[model samples]
Target: MTLRADAVGHAFDGEPVFSNVSLAVDPGEVVAVIGPSGAGKTTLLRFLALFERPDEGTVSFDGTDVWDAPESDRLGLRRRVGIVFQEAGLFDADVARNVEYGLRVRRPWSERLGDELAGLLGRNGTNGAVREALDLVGLADDADRSAASLSGGEAQRVSFARAVAYEPDVLLLDEPTSDLDPRNTAVIEDAVDRACDRGIGAVLATHDMNQARRVADRVAVLLDGGVIEVGPAERVFGSPDDERARKFVAGELVY
Candidate 1:
């Protein structure tokens, strides 16, 4: 499977964010997008998640143009793409339930109704998927804890768990571990690797150049409203064709 952006551009309230941007990911590959703040990394992921339409270009899935598809088809495609925003937007519920939210939403309405009926009969419990997701983020022992009681790092891990619970074909993460400690950051990175091992493609947007160099199979450098360079991670970091990308990778460029 493939999720791709072709010369895509977006504008916010008549202000252009980026233009002529192109990127793509296939199953089992991790593509990292790195840039300064407000360089449109999140906006680009939004387009990939089908939350926003680009003002000038195309976002496609498996070679089919996403926006041109019917709403039903688009919704189906959207469900197949999972996203973790920069913020941890957890619900006011138990940790397991927060992680289970994505799985529940992706379920068929009829299946959800059956679950509701089961809950009425006192048969409700978190599923194996929820437990597995929690385990992936080292939250298996915290399943029963209230989300509100968790620390910021724990909350972020829960958010990551929730996004990956459904095993979406495409994963989009925006600075997923920006606030976590090293241990927690390692956990998140390992989980990402496992997801890719399962043949799930991912797009990671991060500011940590070292993390990008470590985890990304390929890298895209976004600068001055567009992608200045993108290629295999080594080439992009070691010997970028664009002077801006070279400086950015060398720690000489600052936002």
Candidate 2:
């Protein structure tokens, strides 16, 4: 599936945050959104995720307009998309439960009941899925640990695991590694690679040009609330078509 945002625009209190933004994420491809702070990267991601409807333009999944769809259809579409915010946003629960939360809530009632029964009988009880997700983030052994007891990086990994556990068609990440150190950043990057290998389309909003180079198949540069350049990662970073994009890439531009 492909997620496309066509000429999206948004404003707050009569002030435009961004305008005429457009991009797309194709299945199995990773598109990195790189921009300075307050450049509307998060806003663009929100529109793509269907969490917010742009005041102008449309977000379409496989040519179906998300905003025009019914609530149930929208919800269904949302279920197929996973998002990890800037913060971990974990609940006060153990790692396994936190990771299992999305699956439990999104599964059909009968399926949920079956999993609950399996839990009561002491069978795998969704632990298999939970463990697999935790493993993906290098936290398999921390499944029983409390989320509150983990480090900042660990917490973020758990948050990522929770998103990954859903096996979504699309993954949206907003500065997931911003607060992480080098090692944790690598771990998160590896998880993203794994997701893409599984054919899940991803849109990552990050300020780190190097990370964009490593993870993105294509790069979209946002400046002053609009995408100034978008193309193959190497081309966009090495020889951007827009003068502003060139400046931004050369570290000559600052937000």
Candidate 3:
């Protein structure tokens, strides 16, 4: 599957935030969106996530234009896309329940059946999927812990687990590890790698150039709400054709 943004533009309250921005994420590919703060990286990710309809152009998933589709189709499409915001955004529940929230809401009957089957089989059963996600983030033992009791890093891990448990076709991440320490950041980065390993496309918005180098197959540089450079990570960072992108990559330019 492919998630694509075709010449997307957006404005707010008569003020334009960005225009004519286009990018695509192929299945199993990790695309890093790097830019200065206020350059509309989050806005662009919002558009790609189908959270907002762009004022111009379209966001498509698997060859279907999301905005023009029927409501049911849009909803169904959204179910296959997951988003992880900068904040952990966990509910006031235990870790396991928080991880289960998406599946419970989107697949209520299946969730119930999974629980029932798990109990009958004296195992986690399909709900073991939740445990699997927790395990991915190294939180398998924290499943019964109260989310409110979690540290910031743990909360973020739970949030990631929640998103991954659903096995979305596309994962949209907005500065997911910005607030994390090196250890926590490494954990989150590993989770992202696992997602891509499973053929889930990822679009990560981050200011960490090191992260882009480590994780991205391709990089798109956003400047003044437009994409100024886009190509393989090596070329974009090592030999960018755009002067602005070069400065940004060299740390000579501040956002």
lDDT of 1 by residue, 1-255 (tens): 899999999888998899999999999999999999999999999899999899999999989999999998898899989888878999999998888788778754345457566466331444677888888888999989999999888888899899888889999999998988998889889889998999999999999999998899999999999999999999999999999999998989767
User: Candidates 1 and 2: which is better by TM-score?
Assistant: 2
> By TM-score, who's the top model here?
2
- In model 2, which runs have C-alpha deviations exceeding 4 angstroms? 108-124
- lDDT (Cα) of model 3: 0.89
How good is model 3 by TM-score?
Answer: 0.93
Per-model C-alpha lDDT, please? Answer: 0.89, 0.89, 0.89
Residue 1, candidate 2: C-alpha displacement in angstroms: 1.4
Which pairs of residues have clashing backbones in candidate 1? none
- Candidate 2, 120-214: lDDT as tens digits: 74524677888999999999999889999999999999999888786888999999999999999999999999988999999999999999999
Tell me which residue pairs clash in candidate 2.
none
lDDT measured at residue 63 in model 1 versus the true structure, 0 to 100: 90
- For model 1, give the 10-residue run with minimal summed lDDT: 118-127
What's model 3's lDDT at 170?
92
Model 1, runs deviating above 4 Å: 109-126
TM-score of every model? 0.93, 0.94, 0.93
